[model samples]
Target: MSRHDFYENIRNSTRLNHFANLVNLAAIDGDIKPIEEKLLKRFSRKFDVSEENYEKILENPASFPVHAINLKTQRLEFLFDLLRIVYVDNKMDEAEEFLIRKYAVGLGFSEEQALVVINKSKKLFENNFSFDFYQHFIESDED
Candidate 1:
């Protein structure tokens, strides 16, 4: 396949299949935090992949099997991953934005497309967590 075809595959993969690898790698030094782990688990279930597979991915970062296993749609996910990582600490910084944007360009998005992908990823993450905030709120009300 052409290089374009190759990368396109990466852009279209399900968030679960490949994103687990991305998230896990970023967390190795303790950055994942609990909330991130929750989201990663959700993605794992969503794609029918297991947490076991996630661990495997962590053991071998260089291969990135998700790219070869199924790529027709994940480069976008990868770009979003960078965006998510930038926001992992709860806010975006210039360095994070620049890194994701530059990486997006390499993955084949124009500025506009890259922005859209980034924005969507942001939105996805914004709503990704399913905390028991409501429960906490109700409990607080009891006080």
Candidate 2:
């Protein structure tokens, strides 16, 4: 394959892994709810995952390994996507919370940082949680 095609494949693989993570989170509560499925479909589209691959991921998300995102912005966006799935039903359960924390670590956050992000996200998601606001909150801690 050409260099461009090679890089594209790697990027697509990473996106597939990320999408699998979302699928796993959605199914963590035993069955995937209708609302959760809707959100998952939307995410698949955003991630550029094909319908065939989407179904395959849903069949067994655990098969995909967690790929650590390099960019801070990407990591936060990853966390935000997880939070979106957790809150899609208008509630956050223990399983969802636990999975999200694990995912945060996989996305390169420390355990403590995961807790902080999850706790703060729970509150922010309940209000008007925009990515801009969430990014500001996280970055503000560095100053």
Candidate 3:
């Protein structure tokens, strides 16, 4: 494959893995609720996750590796996407919150910063914030 295609594949894999991790959080209560399943299907289509890959991920999500995103803005965007996943079911449990915090830290935020971001993200969800809002907010913060 071409270099760009190669990197794109890797990025797609990472995103799929991350989404799988979020789905795992929803299933932590020993079952995936209907809402959670709907969100999973939505995310799978958004991420271009194939049926074969979906089955693989469902079979064993924890086995997937975490891949790093290099850019700060991209990392923030990634965290926001994870928050969206968490909020999709309209029920953010303690387990989901814990997993999000852990993923945020893994993405390079401090524990305190992660919590702050999570809170901000929750508000964004409540306020029906769009991707443009997130982009503008991040840009304004950099100024």
Candidate 4:
């Protein structure tokens, strides 16, 4: 794929979410277990990403470090939104935690910055308790 296509693919796929990639990675413990295979397949199918790209992602974990940095530069709300989706059901496994740390460090964020990011995610969870409420607030709020 061209460099542009590679970036576009990452941007369009759920794998763009570092947290989601972490969750997916957590599901597989080095081997391609059946359930993990199923989950990956489902994610690929849903995102219209080809198996080749998925394989590339698995083979090279740091290929998207720049993308992770870009995500970090975004507003805290966007970051927390991603974290919330990844940590849905209120649990983050070891693999997910590992990925988050790796990406944060790669983005050149200090330990304090990383902690602040996690704290921001927690605050997001507290501030936006429901979809309807968030929708109402987002629509009404100027700030």
Best by lDDT: 2
Candidate 1 lDDT = 0.50
* Pick by lDDT: 3 or 4, better one: 3
Instruction: State the C-alpha lDDT per candidate.
Output: 0.50, 0.76, 0.69, 0.50
By summed lDDT, which 10 consecutive residues of candidate 1 come out lowest? 134-143
Q: After superposition, how far is residue 21 of candidate 2 from its true place, in Å?
A: 1.8
Per-residue lDDT over 1-143 for candidate 4, one digit per residue giving the tens place of the 0 to 100 score: 99999987766664445534543443434555665555555545444556777677656644444333454334333444455554554555554444455445445566766655554444445433754444344334233
RMSD of each: 14.2, 6.7, 6.4, 8.4
Q: lDDT for model 4, on a 0 to 1 scale?
A: 0.50
- Runs of candidate 3 with Cα error greater than 4 angstroms are 1-15, 21-55, 58-63, 135-143
Ranking by TM-score: 2, 3, 4, 1
Model 2 agreement with the true structure over 1-143: per-residue lDDT tens digits = 99999998976876777779878766756788887787678767767789999999888876775777789898998787556645655677665576678789888888998888888777677755778888888766642
Error of 1 at 68 (Å): 14
Off by over 4 Å in 4: 1-11, 17-52, 67-78, 126-143
Which ranges in model 2 have alpha carbons more than 4 Å from their true place?
A: 1-19, 22-55, 58-63
Candidate 3 local lDDT, 74-99, one digit each (tens) = 87888877666556656566655676
Models sorted by lDDT, best on top: 2, 3, 1, 4
Q: List pairs with backbone clashes in candidate 3.
A: none
Residue pairs with backbone atoms closer than 3 Å in model 2 (clashes): none
